[model samples]
Target: MTKIADFRAMTPDQLSDELLKLKKEQFNLRFQAATGQLEKTHRVGEVRKDIARLQTLLRTKQPAA
Candidate 1:
């Protein structure tokens, strides 16, 4: 799980990379759940929140229009 400060410390490129990784993880988790193979179901919520946090940070980092 990434802390908010960690997200803040990242370059935009790194944040994007992490986001992609998390999204892939999220997909796998869902696949596992659909197959009735999911363990640590808590991970789903954690990933969802992390994705939200990362996206929020990304939005803030965007250049002004």
Candidate 2:
């Protein structure tokens, strides 16, 4: 789980990379659940929150139009 401060400290590029990685994990987790192979049920919520945190951090770093 990524702390909000950790996400805030990362550069936008780094945040993007992490976001992509988390999204991949999220996909895999969903697939596992569908196949009845999921181990850690709580991880889904953790990843979801982490993805949202990264996105929120990235958005805050962007320049306004």
Candidate 3:
């Protein structure tokens, strides 16, 4: 699992890619949970937090108009 600090240091494109991957994983986790196949339910919270962290970093890095 990647650290939030490391993610914050990434370029926008890298952060974007990571965000997309995290979203996909979140979807899978939800599906697994619905079917009672989730091995680690805690991972869902971590992924959601990571996505939020990435988004926050992206917003902070954006140049103001």
Candidate 3 global lDDT: 0.90
TM-score of 3: 0.92
Q: Which candidate comes out best when scored by TM-score?
A: 2
lDDT per residue as tens, model 2, 1-65? 87898888889999999999999999999999999999999999999999999988888899998
Q: Write the per-residue lDDT of candidate 1 for residues 1-65, one digit (tens) a residue.
A: 77899889999999999999999999999999999999899999999999999999999999989
State which candidate, 2 or 3, has the greater lDDT: 2
Off by over 4 Å in 1: none
Q: What is the C-alpha RMSD of each candidate to the true structure, in Å?
A: 0.6, 0.5, 1.0
Candidate 1 minimal-lDDT segment of 10 residues = 1-10
TM-score per candidate, in order? Answer: 0.96, 0.96, 0.92
Clashing pairs in 3: none
Quote model 2's TM-score: 0.96
- What order do you get sorting by lDDT, best first? 1, 2, 3
Question: Worst lDDT window (10 residues) for model 2?
Answer: 1-10
Which is the winner by lDDT between candidate 1 and candidate 2?
Answer: 1
lDDT of 3 at 38: 100
lDDT against true structure, model 1: 0.95
Error of 1 at 58 (Å): 0.6
lDDT of each structure?
0.95, 0.94, 0.90
The segments of candidate 2 whose C-alpha lies over 4 angstroms from its true place after superposition are none
